[model samples]
Target: MPKIIVEVMPKADLLDPQGKAVAGALGRLGHSAITDVRIGKRFELTVEGEVTEQILADVATLADEIFSNQVIEDVTSIRVEEAQA
Candidate 1:
């Protein structure tokens, strides 16, 4: 089996309130060197057979249209890998 990995992240111009809250907590916890933080999402799709270009393309479409929100997030990466037995 094979798998597709997808990564999504918030638009650079948009503010992430959750990430900001985490960053503030880190600062309060004595982590001054940590300047900022941002949050993202990862999705893995396990395929039943050999990975192919068409499958990859289909997954790319899913990543852009379903996995991530185009308005608030961007599809940062899409990759194929062997599924662990």
Candidate 2:
């Protein structure tokens, strides 16, 4: 099987409260060197058959329309991972 992976992340111009909280926690935990953190989402679509260009296109649409909020997030990446035999 092959898997289609979609990555969504908060827009650069927007503030991520969750990310800021995590960053603050990290600093408090003595991870001061870690200056920033941004939370994102990863969606996996496992394909049972051959991967096709149309499928990829459809997945791209789904990533933008269904998986992420366009106002605050962007689809950062799309990738295919082949299963290990």
TM-score of each: 0.93, 0.97
CA shift of 45, model 2, Å: 0.7
lDDT of 2 by residue, 1-85 (tens): 9999999999989999999999999999999999999999998889989889999999999998999999999999999998878
Q: Candidate 1, residues 30-62: lDDT per residue as tens digits? A: 999999999999998899889888989999999
Give stretches of model 2 more than 4 Å off: none
Model 1 earns a TM-score of 0.93
Local distance difference test, per candidate? 0.92, 0.95
- How many residue pairs clash per model? 0, 0
- By TM-score, who's the top model here? 2
Model 1 lDDT, residue 77, Cα: 91
Q: List the residue pairs that clash in candidate 2.
A: none
Query: What's the lDDT for residue 18 in model 1?
Result: 88
